[model samples]
Target: MNSTLQPTALTEHVPQPVTRTERVQTIDLIRGFALLGILMMNIPGFGFPYTRFPLIYGTPGSTDFYTAMGIDTAFSGTMRALFSMLFGAGMLLFMAKKEDLASGHSVVDFYYRRLLWLVLFGVINAYVLLWPGDILYAYGLCGLLLYPFRKLRPAYLLIGMMLCMILPVLRNIQNTVETKQKRTTYWEAVKAEEQKKKLTDEQKKAKEEWENQLKWTKFDTKKDAEIVRKMQLGYGQVFAKLMPRNSNIESRGMYYGFWDMLGMMFLGMALLKLGFFTNKLPTSTYWLTLGLGYSIGLLLGNIQFYDQVAYILDPGAYVDTHFFSVFDLYDLRRGATAIGHASLLLLVYRSGVVPWLMKALANVGQMAFTNYLMQSIICTLIFYGYGFGYYGKLAFHQLYYVVAGVWVFQILFSAVWLRYFRFGPFEWLWRSLTYWKRQPMRLQSEPVPAAPQTALF
Candidate 1:
């Protein structure tokens, strides 16, 4: 039907509020779910550094170790995978609207303009805000490359998704090799220094160089303490201390994230075209998806759980240069679990299992852009020296309490805000910029939908 519609003919519908009655609420609900769920994984990084790792391995049955393991095994990459696919689905939705408006206006303009702004936002987040693990930069890059693949058949899209995953796997392998080489070189230098009866100038220089190189490879409590102090000193001091180590911009920002994120985006597009996101699939199909996805994914995930635990805990593992072993199958495990999650969420949504909860989640999803930025701002202030200065203070498990608190606040705030306003504050700004027109914000003039008589609890 959209193919026959003139672009100008659909002008009135081009930028309608996503909350309108005609919208598919399930997508927004999942997005809202993702918006909150992601904090479960990200709180640690916000409180410390993303690269900050444990010096000693976890005790098998200990509280801290098992907590860390559970979080990583269940959530870490899964949330990111789900979030990336959702973004891809959103893009496809936007394109579908454009097709219906095929009035010859430059869809390219819309696509590029939105992603270009997103790229700028990513830069600010990474450098100015000093959140080194920011994914927006990576998303912008993936999105720039995704527009051309929009019309591919599902089979072709799946093929493309498989191809996109290769580079991240390769990138991880490359990192593992480089880490091994660095460790070997550093240890050899130490051995040589130990053997020397008198320290020669050349040998001393070599030892110092190797020591510096090894500093980043090992986890040192003293180094972590100093870094924490710097974070407490001021924002500028923290920025100076951390920026040099922000190498994710090189690795993840380049090939690794490009592959990992774009692959999921491709999968999302394929799924959307197949009507997966629109509740077109049967409940039985979703149940089977849930069963198979969780079985395969959780199996792969748990297989490495102990190995990863052992890798971090065993000093011998690091000394033996086997630190990279844990990540060997990271990509595949995450991909499987991500599908599992998507299936579970879709099944619940299609079943109308919890209308009130679903409505709240949809509100959150509609305002995800606003809430994401909000989280960054709030957490930085809460943890940095500039605000309450709680950086690097909490234990791994306790940090989640902060996450829970934030979620409660966001959900309650979002629900209340959406009742009166058509868009979240940041969403309105982004939409205005993307359209180059000031969109409506207040809902006072619009007819209000009748409120439910009963309380939601």
Candidate 2:
């Protein structure tokens, strides 16, 4: 194997086997790991009250808070970054293959159709399925942007990645600074209204508006209970409440995430170009990657997670908003940790340290699409009012039990399904849609790849 980072020769490009035939087992395993790990991060949101989870508020070092913080430190932004990067790498793989397979129609047309379908799926997930945090819409939207950058040089891709990654922090800083400015003006308006002199109407109105804004920003006991009330009513009712928040820029999901997803995808493309995901790197390289990435990433991730949790729970009138300025550097930590995690998984597999475990995880990754959507269905059935009515009933820590159960079931189910099937149900549907022909879903008469492109990137 060549050790240097260089492009494959023109002769290396050949007709791809098929879009549905996944050749990269390592990518599948990593994707499966990221998909499962992400659920750990999302379980709280699905099982407990939004914004205010199972926290003994203001108790920074308590076991409850520490447990949640620990989980966040381990997963949090890292898994999402890994997932996004993997998507980018998959895009490169898919396009590379499709370019060879294109005949009468253009490959770009097929790519657009795939993205548009994803956007449709995202809509269904968000509206009908009622997961406000459904990421498919964001992923598809960013993916549309990715097409133009598909053929960009690795150096340019890295530059694009840096800009996308950095923009969110810059936005956060702008928001924080602007928020402080509003606080200052809010107090001034109040002070003016309290003065002995006659007040201007604008100042009086400003006082009322700013006071309301301040009141709305803080989540108190009553607000938390009211949120629980809305969610516990009916799925339709909750849907009405959450649609705006998930779709718009002002909402937390889009606000914090708008650029970060694109940046991570670009970074993934760069890494894939470097052959980092191909298990082509030397063992020494993998070991060094694991060491430096985790050390630098996890340490910062821990401190930042702690501070954010503490700041959210702070009851002080003068909360330190500056602590949130740490968002500027948070992605580097997350991206690093994600890389560290991928390094560990790849190293483990390459060394044949735990071959059976690798095969199981790879199987799960192969069925990732079906498993990912199944998570949403199962979680909602457990948490929503329409299902078991466990809405707002569980603490953040308790949600992990449900996640663990699903994790076990998915691993086993995927393995079992692949034993007799060509693809997971959803994967088949996606492939059928992409190719304009129904894909074979059952086991073939002869020996065949148990799980083909079902979960393949």
Candidate 3:
């Protein structure tokens, strides 16, 4: 008795990967939907040197213009918002069980280990793969700060989320004020120069600032051409060109965007804790959420879209007329839209009318990590010089053809791959690394375990 141990004693406290039966199907479905939707916004960045000018890419009211407008209105930041929220929910899911603590294995250790690996994967995605818009690095870094708040009440998490959002809103206000000041100074300086008057230092600085900003926002054919040429260079040359941009995004951009991601994550945690992501809420509640979320989100989103169209038509006038009011509510619009999207999808899932489509999407979501990296690899190869070298050649609307192809491939591939395997390739690798052991990969011939009808949360 003193020397022996029961089977439960040895196995019950060991940490393990989430089984398929334990997964929340609604979460997977939403994730899969978000993964595909992200490509709608990302395709432009993949195929074009700059994505600001639908007017230049195509005439006003053309297919390109409408495409850009539609994407801006419907997707833009919404897919990423969904992903961020899901990531937060996942953190709680990972730490939900406390049995590991009894076996001297801290869940915190596993969580950090998972995040560090994600950080490395993000580096590989951004630097090695040359995808400057990669979100993994930002997510990994932000996730490091999530563990401390895991046990907070849902209400407290919501409060934290709102608090975090305040920073980005304030930043928008600051940027708007600074931009207006720069424009005023530059115009005054222009008038003074015309009168043969000496320019003040502040005016000179403002002129330079405004011009630099124009270099990015205002279309210049020559600059665009140079970007195309660089993207069409050899791997080493392209990497050299992309390095600084990726560095800036990883450093400065990540810093500024940290609170945004963190806030969404907090919201995700709150939602999961409240049973929103698990589809445990009442049907009427979901209906009400869909109604209110879309009503508010679309209203604000359309206003922002109108401003975007106005900017495309006349940047100068758009700047003069548009303050940061709509921009300040950017988070709210996307956040609401994301929630609406989730509600609609959940309603559909609950209805069971599109079982095949839902099942396929859930499979895709299950393999989301692999599919995400695959998108980067496939898109870079298609657009970069070392492969197809089609960068900057496709119009705004044409890129969706590529997106549609990727979606078809990923959906089919995920369904087939999971038939024989328990996890996506990357997911298995990540779990293996986190556990410091090779987790099971291949599905055995045993009877499939039925999924829980309700989520643990």
Candidate 4:
């Protein structure tokens, strides 16, 4: 009866230990989610003729309201932010490992070499490859800039990131104002041209055909197949050199998506330094962050998404007058929303929700460097002429199937391939170049073996 619990009985125990490999699993999961999200966003452009911007900026609300609003904001913008953050996190990891080596030589040399190679890879992807919607070039270029800044204090890096984020917002506003003014002038000219080209019955019919051709260049595959051929073949000789109505300013990937990527990267770097990735935060804190972010981001995100849909349906006074200006507030709102989304994702990974799902995501993530490019490669084959030539044919909703198909393939391929290989093909090449030595490509050790199942992140 005097037997009070012994001190040993009261103590808690730390059970199993995690290896370096398991620690990397978290990173792989993050990358997997990011890569998948990216595919979701890019699928539209891959299947559609894509006459305009694939993102909401080009053609708002063309897709279903729910799809446009729910998917675009939640997945498109936010996922991209997550991916960029992962990239930044990876940079820190790579640098840290190098530093841990304590090699007599500086790691900066190898760092620059990797970035330079990445830039080259981006260039190849942009021009020589299929899809022009390349982010590697921007990442490579900005990452090069980040080289010096990486060594700066975390606080300074955060400040620099804020400035970069603001720059894009300001530029967007400026462009919006200027675009409205120019569009008015352009519309008037187009109307006047239509009037001047008034023609006789036969000429009028021919003119209508010409106008249609000008709009899509691939219109009327039945009777006007010849015309379509001419348009396609002559595209190089005729319009290839024709100056874009707008200057080269927007065409450059730098101005379009570079800042977005940079913002995410900086945030990632800051979070990584803050120990966000190290599972240091309380579970309650993570849940609270996710709840707040999802609520605010989803609410605002839905509003903007619906706004785009409404604008597209009627496209009346508001469409003509306001256009890119209406939801200026939402653009900034997206940043807040992205924070929430990123926070939630991090929490999931830390919490070890679904171990199997996390493992799958991590597998895909481990091969992310390969999978990212593989996406572009596979998408180009699915959409472009050199492959199936299905581009511009599939409807918005129909594109989802292609995306789903690709997702299944990627997951299956990643899991199976990883069973036999150490790193993804491209990942291995990257490591080899980074280390200046060939890396082992096969599994040198047995699987760690799965543990008791739990909820996945």
TM-score of each: 0.84, 0.87, 0.93, 0.74
Which residues of candidate 1, in runs, are more than 4 Å off?
1-19, 49-52, 99-104, 174-219, 245-252, 315-326, 445-457
Please give, for residues 1-457, the per-residue lDDT of candidate 2 as tens digits: 1222232322323222232243577887888898889898878667676546424434566766777778767677888898899889877766663343324555566677777888787787777877766778778877887877888888999998888877877777787766566666666776775786555665666566556654543556887888778777677877777778656632456656768888899999898887788778788998999999899888887877766665554422434346355556878889999999999999888878898888888788878878888888898888877788787787666777888899999999999998888778887777678667666677763233322221224
* Highest-TM-score candidate: 3
User: What is candidate 1's lDDT per residue for 371-415, written digit by digit as tens?
Assistant: 887888888888888778999888767778899899889999899
Candidate 3 lDDT by residue in tens digits, 1-457: 0011011222334666666755778888899999889888888778886734735433566888777767877777999999999999888877665535564778778889989999999999999988999999899999999989998999999999999888889988898888888888999999999999999999999989887776655677777889999999899999999999999999999888898899999999999888898888889999999999899888888888777666655655666766766878888899999999999999998888999999998898988888889899999999999889999998878999999999999999999999999889999898889889888888883234332321111
Model 4: ten consecutive residues of lowest lDDT: 1-10
> Model 1 — which ten-residue stretch has the worst lDDT?
448-457
Q: List the residue pairs that clash in candidate 2.
A: none
TM-score of model 2 vs. true structure = 0.87
User: What do the candidate models score in CA lDDT, each in turn?
Assistant: 0.70, 0.73, 0.83, 0.60
| Best of the two (1, 2) by lDDT | 2
Tens digits of per-residue lDDT for model 4 on 1-457? 0001111110112111112243455455666887887787878655553443223333544564346555756765766677777678667655543232234445566666777777777666655553455667667777776655566667876786787777876777886665555445455555756899544554544445434434542233453343223223332422332223112422564666677778778877786666555445566776776777778777777777666655444443443666455366543455566667656666766656766777788788777778888988888677665566666666666777888888889999999998888677886776576657676677764345223110111
